[model samples]
Target: MNIRLNLVATTSLVALLSVSAASAQTMEELIEGAKAEGMLTTIALPHDWCGYGDIIASFKAKYPFLTVNELNPDAGSADELEAIRANKDNKGPQAPDVIDIGLSFGPQSKAEGLVQPYKVSVWDEIPDAVKDADGYYYGAYYGVMSFAVNTDLVDNVPTEWEDLLKPEYAGQVALAGDPRASNQAILGVLSAGMARGAAAGTASGEAGLQFFKELNAAGNFVPVIAKAGTLAQGTTPIMVMWDYNALAARDTLAGNPPVEVTVPTKGTLAGVYVQAISAYAPHPNAAKLWMEHIFSDEGQNGYVKGYCHTARFNTMVAQGKVPQDLLDALPPAEPYEKAYFPTVEEQDANKNAVVSGWDSVVGANVQ
Candidate 1:
């Protein structure tokens, strides 16, 4: 992910101009506007174990008047982008009211003018690095990239990026598809690069490309898989996965071959799940309402049940909501604090180069 401070200033200016042109309304007024419109909010999100269902349930409970429809494409970011691109011409019901996409794709969506801006009141609680300046997108939750090791397969678990390249672990390690293929997998490579002293945010940097090339040459690369259960059950000794998936897998692998998840001692990349309103949403009022509700205290707390990290730092700390044990399980937050999210310009300039690099260095090995 790329982070550019200038984009935030640009977005803020646009939002200020937008508000100046329209009459400002309070939160209650916005809710009333939403109710009067009888609008429906459509969402596009992944069907993975990222806690989308939990968020949906909360939204339904709060605004019974507003209708919420979801379309689970179960496709990669590129596929989702294509769907959004196709809808631009049709302007059909398939057009989303809101989109919950991976962080890496947030810039592409913003750059294409497919996203609308609406900053919530609690926006200040979120770090600037994880959010868009114009309110086009806000990260709802995040997962740190980490290694899941099957204790039964190897006596010693790898604690750093360099450890994965050991001769003994050759052909034993597995990664998510190329970063270009999956946002999470891309962060996995970027995190390893960061540990090697690469410049932050830019994906085409030497550290990132070289690190991926080595992982590929080691025969550790794996394409996206529908079922990771077998791997968690020891079918594969080691795999790169997000914190939630790793935790879920470990919970599932309780009896048989126990699995352990570690945020590498060297460092790890954190991928955020960002939410944005559609540029041409049918229910703008309801879409804004949905954003307000999700960032509210009640909604953010629900993530704790699924072991997902909420984006609002102050709220989490104020509620005393985070469990002590889970806090212990978390890697130090400093790295995440300094984490990056790409800007529209950086993404536009480097996306092709980065994708092509991954294709040559990593995708070639996967095939």
Candidate 2:
């Protein structure tokens, strides 16, 4: 079933067969094939991360006959690739059928020949830059970098990027991870530097590095990687992370300690993650079905529910698929109006530069 189409409409689940790149095998045929396979393995998807808990549950409720096995929820994008390679010879459900990976990994996965092409029904709605030309991978959802604050621990709330460098936030500002290794932390630095007109490239993302160096020197920087629980426990009173994670943390500590997610007025980076099917999926039909579900109205809505922007967010908003409350809670959309997406090549080339510069320029200042 190699039929292909890129319908831009708000495609209904019932009409999926007509729009799917896998249309030659209709929705019914795919469902039947999936049932025969009887199971799907999805790797690196934490149940609570980005509302996967709800999404994975919805999939199970929708198809009770098929079993879905989730493995290594905390695994990284590279780990997902490793899982695919290690299990290529295995036909069991131990092998991942699908993956949700960082954007930088998408093109690399395609180059490695680890991902297969199967465009979702809402293909035309997604931006071309976020998806591979041959449909090997496509963006699922994206989150903007933001400040997560523990309201109970800190009296003053920072609503701007510059606020983190203040003496008030001394020893309070924490990164999501080491800038040299963490995608989230690197982005936090990038967002800060870019907002101040910093250029990001192979020359060590200097603007970002310089901004972070100043932050560290101010005694505001903490070397620890802060998680939601860390903020709740006051280990790191302020954290730089994705808005969805901040929102999720807020919801988690609803009553005891208020957690507030802030999108800096100066600007922030929107981090996009892509989804792809394994080239050697043990259950290819189930993998295709999974993709169909993700790009459908229901699936895209899941992204909104998780506080992340769906790839087809604009289309969904125009179609009124997103509710007003969720819309209201979203970080102000203006900063994202001019959001920049670094190309895969740029991400790779500049990574070493950033890491090298971090050690020399920023790391020493970090507490």
**Candidate maximizing TM-score:** 2
Query: Which candidate number has the best lDDT?
Result: 2
lDDT of 2 by residue, 1-367 (tens): 0001122213235334422446466789889999999988999776656888888888888888879988887666767888899998998867999999877778778778787778776788787867876677888887878888998888899998777877888888887666765566666777777777655555436777887889888888877778777887888999998888888878877856888778876645667788999978998898888888888887877777888788888777777888898778766666565455666665555555666789888865332
User: TM-score for each prediction?
Assistant: 0.78, 0.83
Off by over 4 Å in 1: 1-50, 65-67, 91-93, 102-104, 152-155, 201-205, 233-236, 252-257, 319-353, 365-367
lDDT of 1 at 176: 50
Query: Where does candidate 1 have its weakest 10-residue lDDT segment?
Result: 1-10
Model 2 pairs in collision: 47-53
Q: What is candidate 1's lDDT per residue for 260-303, written digit by digit as tens? A: 77777565565667888777777777888878877887667655
- lDDT, model 2, position 307: 81
All models: lDDT? 0.64, 0.76
